[model samples]
Target: MERTGTTRRRALIGAGAAVTAALSGCSSDEPGARRDAPPSVSAETLLRRRSAALSSALLGRYDAVLAAHPGLAPRLAPLRAQVALHVEALSPTGDRPRPASSPSSSSSSAGAAASPSPSSSASPSAAVPADAGAAVRELASAERSTAAAHTAALTGAPPEYARLLASVAAAGAVHVYLLTKGSR
Candidate 1:
């Protein structure tokens, strides 16, 4: 088992190391450039803005579904409120919410608080299906897409923001399962 012949994994790892070393040294020609370090301030702000926008869009989708089919409000409102919290959390100036309560308690409280109001007046950017089950399926589809977008955004996000996005994305996936299961 001690043979010294080159293996595919070893060769690939060696090539990867060589590539990493080459890339790590590719700093800007400017005098103050830091090798292997990306600029964080502006990038972080942009990431926050983009994440907030995604949450807001998803929030709007929730609103659209509610406006089209008000009967679904009891089930959808809690999820919509969660998306609103995501918008706030992702804002550049917004402070993250404290996780003081257990997830079940917090969700139940949001559900109680968001009980179907006749005046939830957010305009729907996209048409919602008239059928209630179809509308639930549409929301599930939106949740899946939004979760993917949030997960994709984690590539270069700061660790704190990345953690938040990951949690939100996980919630979105759960929302998908709940919506689909309930619709059936």
Candidate 2:
């Protein structure tokens, strides 16, 4: 009669086969990916670029408020400087920002912010409320919006980038408090 129970030879053979299959799965699938298209950017690059752009737009908004109401300078100077630093920090290594006519679209950034040239100066936007109190509120709204965006981005950012976002978001919160204080 044939033995029905599994022999050592059979068990060893099955284990060897299983390990081979598992290892095959572990090896990289080298040939299946398409490589013909332009290389895509890494997630870090995209995140940094977006953060820098946000800061740049905020800087332009500050410029607009200052242009529209120069009297607010003493109140806004330090905050604007902080924002300019944020822009610098968020920008990729070696990239210098230039004063831009259109911060959202313009690709340049600065080491020391370039004086906004005549053509590039943020005009006294009609959107700026004439009342300084109202204008401060408007600026506060912008700070709140940008801070929220930075906070939202934290989940996806790498460790270092997330830290930067967190700090900037915190600073924005403080700016909101400063601007709204006493004006309330």
Candidate 3:
């Protein structure tokens, strides 16, 4: 049967519409339909987050040390500042709580509050050392361990994160050296 131009045009249009709908349905089922969406967090990002947490813990250690041995403040203050900087750099938002501004009040309060009692159980590391030398040595050891962790994490990090981790590791190394060899 012969078809009129109008009829042929209508049929062609309808067929095109059906094909377009089928293709659209197929594309909607694909995982890449939202290609513009932000990607989910990667393992590397999680690792960096853990690294940041480690940095935070190190800062906490510094605070504990200072609280325990205010006499070491003259020597350890600079190292503590460096560790704070590292925590800031490693954290994605740089929003970590800082040590209280009033060092004497904060340190004394932290010292008293954190002091171990016979009934209170806490991690040995959380306890402030009895002497300034011991505090320095403890911080030096912690710094070394943190730096080693950063170094190990670097192997699996992306290039940008690796650079950041390396810089943090270097800063930790410097703190370790100053803690061990610099006059306290």
Candidate 4:
């Protein structure tokens, strides 16, 4: 039997209401569920933390390079200072503490012992290259890698953090240039 227009309209309205009711019930009716949900950290906060960690690691590397080649202090000092600046910029509130000892202190001492003293003969067991050129190349490579990381991190960072990362990346690029120039 064919349905009347009024009957069809009524059925359609009833179906729509039923669907709406089903969807409405799908949400949690318990008030506790909303209240008990854990707070989430924002992506920007996480990115900032990661950038801060990267800056710290770079600072450690600078320390290692400096310790291994004390003679290069005059040149490397500025780069180390710049890395420290980056670390501070990345962590304006200083969330992470600086380590008491340099990351490569142990290796630096071992390398120092193996290399010739100012008044002694050179040895073969040096952990790092004895030449300043080699050290400069190593530092330049590290700076390039850091610059690339900062560039990649810019994608997810908040506006202020993005600008900071961009400035750091630019400084790192300049560092690489200066290091390369000095090595030649």
Per-candidate Cα RMSD to the true structure, in Å, reads 11.1, 6.8, 9.8, 9.1
TM-scores, all models, native as reference? 0.62, 0.66, 0.62, 0.67
Residue-level lDDT for 84 in candidate 2? 79
Model 4 residue runs over 4 Å out of place are 1-38, 92-130, 182-184
Candidate 1 Cα misplacement greater than 4 A, ranges: 1-41, 94-125, 182-184
Instruction: Kindly list the per-residue Cα lDDT of model 2 for residues 1-184, writing each as its tens digit.
Output: 8889899999999999999999887765647645575777878778888887777777777777787889888788778878877877777664545554555542223312532222333445536787888888988998999999999999999999999999999999999999998334
**Model 1 agreement with the true structure over 98-181: per-residue lDDT tens digits:** 342455665534432332322333454477888988888988998899899999999989899899999999999989988988
Model 2 clash tally, residue pairs: 5
Mark the regions of model 2 whose C-alpha exceeds 4 Å error after superposition: 1-38, 94-126, 182-184
Encode model 3's per-residue lDDT on 1-184: one tens digit a residue. Answer: 8765678779899999999999888885676687677888777768867887787677778777776767777677666666666655666543344444565665334332322221222246488678878767887898999999999999898899899999999989988888888664
Q: Candidate 3: minimum summed lDDT over ten consecutive residues — where?
A: 113-122
> Which lDDT values do the candidates have, in the order given?
0.75, 0.76, 0.71, 0.69
The TM-score measured for candidate 1 stands at: 0.62
The TM-score of predicted model 3 comes to 0.62
Of 1 and 4, the candidate ahead on lDDT is: 1
Higher-scoring candidate on TM-score, 3 or 4: 4
Least accurate 10 contiguous residues by lDDT in model 2:
111-120
Clashing pairs in 3: none
